[model samples]
Target: MAESRSCDEVLKAAFPSIVQKDEVQKEFSHFLVSKDLLPAITRYLHTQPGLHGRLTLLWAVDNRPTRNTYGLHYLFTLEPSHRWMLLSAELAGNDRLFPSITPHIHAAQWYEREIRDMFGLIPQGHPDLRRLVRHEHWPKGTHPLKKDFLWDHVLGRQQGEHHFRRIEGEGVFEVPVGPIHAGIIEPGHFRFSVAGEPIMQLELHHFWTHRGVEKLFEQQTLTAAVPLAERVSGDTTIGHSLAYCQAVESLLHLEVPRRGRYLRSLFLELERLHNHLGDVGAICNDTAYALPHAHCSRMKEQIMQLNDRLTGSRFLRGVTRVGGVAIDLTAAQLAEIVAEMDRIEQDFSELESIIAHNASLIDRLETTGVLTERTAWDHAVVGVVGRASGLDQDLRRDRPFAAYDELPVKVVNYRYGDVRARMRVRMDEIHESMRLVREVRLKIPQGPVAGEPSRVAQTGEWALSAVEGWRGEILYMVTAGENGTIQRCKVRDPSFVNWPAIQWAVIGNIIPDFPLINKSFNLSYAGNDL
Candidate 1:
């Protein structure tokens, strides 16, 4: 497995583009490199002929002692079997200026800005270096993730300084989208410079409901943080849970039971199957394809209902605790699940095939939101978006954690990087998830599901845990040896990396089609807001 390669080997293979490489600590490989080399390094790994840089996750950490953001860490997981390495590059704090990986690795844009916004570390030459998940009136230098940023002082943060930016051109009319929109979804503002519907420039502002999730998690205990993590994004409970649990497991060195491991994978795929169905249906609904949209939404509801019946929560919350799975499956339920999956898979396949062949449906999605392979990698897309764009970097198959390590799993990849390609990947993955579910159900072992977590975590140690979430790789890095609670925690959603790639897709497209393209990516606003 490429997961087995040492930090030394990874460094040696991709040495020229890399400036400084070494192990930061066990399980976390760290690299210090020139800022100018980042875009080149992004291309070296993420968009190379083969998968050299399969972006795992990119997040910035606030070093408590220094009271400043220490490093902008980008984890690029490598393709195993091939003689390649995933670049884990970090641009240091003092020399905060870094080149835009957006030009080379499309997914890195938002990550760079998120780091830019939260840490105040600017990506010097970035192309659309706009503020994300930060308010327009929130004061210039008040980065929330910093140690000194006090929420209690919110009422007195010096709000008004005439913060105005220009969208000037000869005939360039300004279009202001919402901090509050017509839809009931969360609020975000989009300012576009347009000449007749063709987008001349676009600016996205994303801090409508900030919620302060990272800071909130810092205040709560491990068990208490579970609910916050579960609520980080409404639908990604399992994904966030798995990432957090893996972090705890590494901390305590707990070996989850075979049964618990299988159950974990089962619940995760269940998460994937349902979300992808809902998202795919949503994309069609945006395209005005009612029949398929209705059918797919109904089918998706069935998937969620299955989770409610089995896990006792519609979104599968609390089923996964720190050490292992909180709920165990019975043999009879497993058999029934296998039987039900067999039928559900067939129904979905038929409905999807009908939708795929419809002429109007094809016309709507054939070339819309075209994110090329080069852009997809540069932006460090994950899950459906990355897979569809031919990035082919799935954490499950590559890293093989939990029950997935024992099973035969394939990462479905599509090359065109358009709306149809994104939809097709989600469709194929639904089938693959179904097959895995059946196999896991049959192989369900008899054992205890939960492990008792240790009362105290050892001090001053660092650990990283990664799980292949339905969306993409979910990363959780921790450090807490000095105190009773977490000293520093960095949470990264795939959208942190993927959201900026949409900027490229929106360029030159009709304004109305932007929604279609955006839905195809279907990035989590809630996840990004945190």
Candidate 2:
């Protein structure tokens, strides 16, 4: 295991080209390896015992203007140690090619394709190099994320249909659903190949709502990027904003006030509370049980009202800033929040009991949309989806960000890996979040909510922030440009990772059950599309 080996020992064994090891943040270790060794090192880290072989993120940075090279970063976390190891490689000149890790690591599939679509960096051995982020109408050879590409440039649309893979067999038929759904949900195309009632294969197509968020980040000032980050995903405002703020704070070496940390945690838990409450109810709604679903909506609405009372926004936007929070909670507001927590908990308990005693709802959820533990790991699923599938990894407890470091988190996990299991995880999490909010309110310190923003250092530095959002782990990687401006910001929403698992989960289930299975996961289309 990488945990037992010292940094020097691991470096000596791996023989990386350039190593930057820091002791202050034991969770991080950076290495610059040659492009040729990239795949081998990645495979080694993933296959080795005690390392847990989890690939957290794979992203590319366009450094052609400054460094005359495109840099690739592979972020991995070793279990038990909770340490992050980054393997980086540079593709110089016109030979922008690197071996694809997807063949060995299934989770790297979409990432590799995304690099091909956005940066024009070819993953040489990638099995399927079709466009991932860019739509079929997008002009060929137009890589939007490249340094030479204009942020606001518009391209003429080309008319063509995306070719989805077809399954050939007796009694096999295809059903295509929504790039535009009947509901007000975001756009995503799902092609399901079915044999009678059972799904044979499912192919998903997203990026319909791709808004050039990363390109927009390149245009914003360091301080001005927080609000933009908050808007990355409407449901995950706190998660994305907090992750961005933490990354900037890490780069500037700024310490948030103790009270501010608690407040941030409080906001995070509140965000989790409403989201989980709504998801639990939505799962019940999928079973045609409207009572629990309506009750869940009511509870969620109450939480949002509380959020509006505490922060200025219903979704808790604009509350997070670089170095600390934008606002502090008054004593009266804190007391009200505590009282709200009690009511929410009590109400949630009653609603949970009602859903649990419903045999029909249980039948609809249990043994349906089962995402096995193996499938979950292969896709690198996270959050409630990953927890329900028996993956014992949670960033809050494993990485310990914000007030989570001071307050213990009770991670809820289930081995069933079904819709019921996923709902149960959310049910347990709601209580856990309520308990955390109470703890934060009782122990919150008295101090200023925010610290002065530190002057941007001219040095080019990179930092990573991971937040355990309600859906899953939200990761942000930021690199400082000249004069402390952001050179590049890579956002990895949990939905981006968990969406792939849905295809596998729906394999044995009937077509009608697809909606129920999909709701069980409840991924964010906007977040994934971004």
Candidate 3:
């Protein structure tokens, strides 16, 4: 094989036409590449050993009615350097066709499909150009992201059909689940191609809760959008809100106070603790092992109660603001949190002991729903799922944010890629989160929790913010419009990336075990739809 080369070296040798764009933001290095050459460059950046880049996100901005064009931005995280590279390409007013990178980069598949649905930009060589975000009822030719499309515009429903892929063979049959499900879960449809008891293939249809969140962000002031971000996923309020705030802070060159930084990290870990605890119980419950499940639920409730006392919200909403945190921690509150962590840790230890001794639960989880490392990487899976599959990437350790740079963090990983492995990851992470909370109590400084913006947000300037949420990584990309108004806000929850992995993970598992496998990942339907 030929030697791997740096991005600059490759650009200089192969594509000199792609020039460096002026630096408009501090978060990433910007470059402007030809629309046709985008696929080739993306392949090199993603595959080349020297760069070791992972395609972080792909999004489009409508410059229509202003420049009569649509611009595409592909963000790549250089894994080796932990830095960001953004390649931008433009489609003229009349041209909506762009070469598809999905044929070479599998991770770009859903993003490309979403672009096609929302912006009417066609990916010429895409294998599947099926509507992703727009449901069957959405009118044809309705591109909601365009500048002329008002956020409040209502359109008449049009009849359409979504075609799902099918595998045909002698004994192959299809089993369809729901866009609506039992319990209080959100909507998602799962189709399984089965041969007797084993699944031949599994595919999921999501986006039932699509709320036009990105479009709603348009024209909203930075301060006013925090609550909006908080609601992106009810369970991930801190993750999404912090990601949004960090991007806005990046734009205004604002530095949160030391105390606020520690506080943010504490709250984020608390959020992780509650979610992981609940999932552990839910996964156990799926196996008919209700003892551990009940205890785990109790532990989760205690954490939520702690959150209510500390932040005045069980989900930790309304605490994160544009510059920093809206709430401050008193000495008594700090002591209370530390004491609570001690008690929860003890209770979790006993619960884990019970789970470990339960042979029936282990039998169900072990060797079930295995997602290989290659498959996880291909889907760009994040958080607990990716770690369980042996993808050793964590933003907290790889790209530290808040107080993570100061506090010690252990990235728990497992190579088995089974339901058991996923459960173990969450179990380990719960302990780690408790440790982080205690560390924050010790090292946090006394200071203001908020900071004032020192710089102005320039029009067309964009920044990216990433947080390692309980489930995995949450990314927010914010672009400024006139007078510091949001032009576009791109939110990427971990569920959006990991949802595709579940389909691959369930291939050989039995139909009855699907619930256990699904609960292992515990993805957010609301987050993915948004």
lDDT of 2 by residue, 125-219 (tens): 99998889988899888998898899999888998778899999889999999989977788999999999989989999998989999989988
**Tens-digit lDDT track of model 3 for 1-530:** 12223555565566678877654654456789989999989988888877767788999999886788899999888777767788999998799999999998888899999999988999999998888999888998888888878899998898888788989989999999998777679999999999999998998888999999998899588768999999999999999999999999988889999899999999999999999999999999998889888898998999899899887899999999988899999989989998998998998898889889988879889999999998988887888999999988889998789988899698899999999999999999999998998889889999999998877898888788999999899999998888879999999999998998899999888999998899999999999999
Report the Cα lDDT for residue 274, model 2. Answer: 94
Badly placed stretches (over 4 Å) of model 3 are 1-7
The number of the candidate with the highest lDDT is 3
Worst 10 residues of 2 by lDDT: 16-25
Q: Is candidate 2 or candidate 3 better by lDDT?
A: 3
Write down the TM-score for model 2.
0.97
lDDT of each: 0.74, 0.88, 0.89
lDDT of 2 at 412: 98
User: Which model is ahead, 1 or 2, in terms of lDDT?
Assistant: 2
Q: Model 1, clash count?
A: 13
Inter-residue clash pairs, candidate 2: none
Between candidates 1 and 3, the one scoring higher on lDDT is 3
